[model samples]
Target: MSAVPGTVQTVGLFAGQHVLAELEGVDPALLDDEPFLRRTLAEVLDLAGATVCDVISKQFEPQGVTVLALLSESHASVHTYPERGALFVDVFTCGTRAKPERAVELLTEALRPTSAQVQTINRGEAEAPADGHREGAS
Candidate 1:
């Protein structure tokens, strides 16, 4: 059904948080920096108290980067588009232990995107994530 605004609603089966962001106008260099992205994602996840199992990243031939982390709670990832000076981030976690939304905020703060579109959702709930910021974020 529908989640009542201003009230916390219980999810059907999985009580999880999923944060998806679209960050635009980020530094192209930062977008292409696989090391920085990897380290930042790892550090933020850690700060969020997530148990990171492993992190894998790939630097594209011409540009761009993709960093994905396997978390004991779930998964977090970033896909960059250097040519467009943008990136897409996803932080999904099971249960209430990990602060997935905080992770996204950290990523956004670090990337310093000119425009950000971020969405947070309660998994198995019917309500769509409310728009926060421009479409560039999530």
Candidate 2:
């Protein structure tokens, strides 16, 4: 039974976690240092159990930096605003091998922001109801 062109095939269930953080009142110098930011991200991912594949970064004129790490589990990134002393950090990992939340936490620690806003998102299949209760059998 094989008769299809551009058909969708089931590939089991998928699950992943995404962690986002907004760090404020950080040191502008740290935010503009591309090399240090890249190294920090790589080390953070490793400590969070993520395998680093490749890293790419750019240093902006005036002041700013963006560092991205491609990971075996998924990927992680950081975008900085040196003028404002703030940065946005994101770490996402597929499957259960890595901890995205820990990555964010470690990032927060490394940056030492005056304040941090963090959010955790559960992605992929088999999510519970939004109201936090399973539907009764019908």
Candidate 3:
């Protein structure tokens, strides 16, 4: 039998932040439409210089509620729940700080909200954390 591969730990440096933005009271249809949601999501990730790793979505019947999650290594994701008109967005990027800000702007434009809130958490070399804590959050 071949030997099992061991975990590799690499340390990279950069300056950026982990941003989490949430919007409340959004129309479910906005998320129910797959094409529109996917397009917008892809655009946001592209702006952050991130690649789309995977996506998981769930839609409810009758109520027309939907939840979408876009996972990425660039440290960002867009989560949406249409039924409740709510959206939860998280962006974590290293080596690039402006990406997250642009992501927030792009999302806000794509997803128009009655009242939207944005919160930015500074991350990067200043906040270099150890291993075993969290991935894509260095």
Every candidate's lDDT: 0.88, 0.90, 0.66
Tell me the spans in candidate 1 whose CA falls farther than 4 Å from its real position: 1-13, 125-138
Candidate 2 lDDT by residue in tens digits, 80-136? 999999999999998787899998898889999999999999998564577767567
lDDT of 2 at 24: 99
Looking at model 1, the pairs that clash are 21-137, 21-138, 22-136, 22-137, 22-138, 116-137, 117-137, 117-138
- How do the residues 1-138 of candidate 1 rate in per-residue lDDT, one tens digit apiece? 448767876643356889999999999999999899999999999998788999999999999899999998899999999999999999999877789998988888999999999998888533344654534455
| Candidate 3 residue-wise lDDT, 1-138, digit = tens | 325567555444655677788887667788566667667776777775666666555545553433343444455555666667887877777655337777777888787887788888876555445654555664
lDDT of 3 at 1: 30
List TM-score per model, in order. 0.79, 0.82, 0.64
Residue pairs with colliding backbones in model 2 are none
Clashing pairs for model 3 are 26-85, 75-92
Steric overlap count per candidate: 8, 0, 2
What's model 2's TM-score? Answer: 0.82
Candidate 1: lDDT over CA atoms?
0.88
Better of 1 and 2 by lDDT: 2
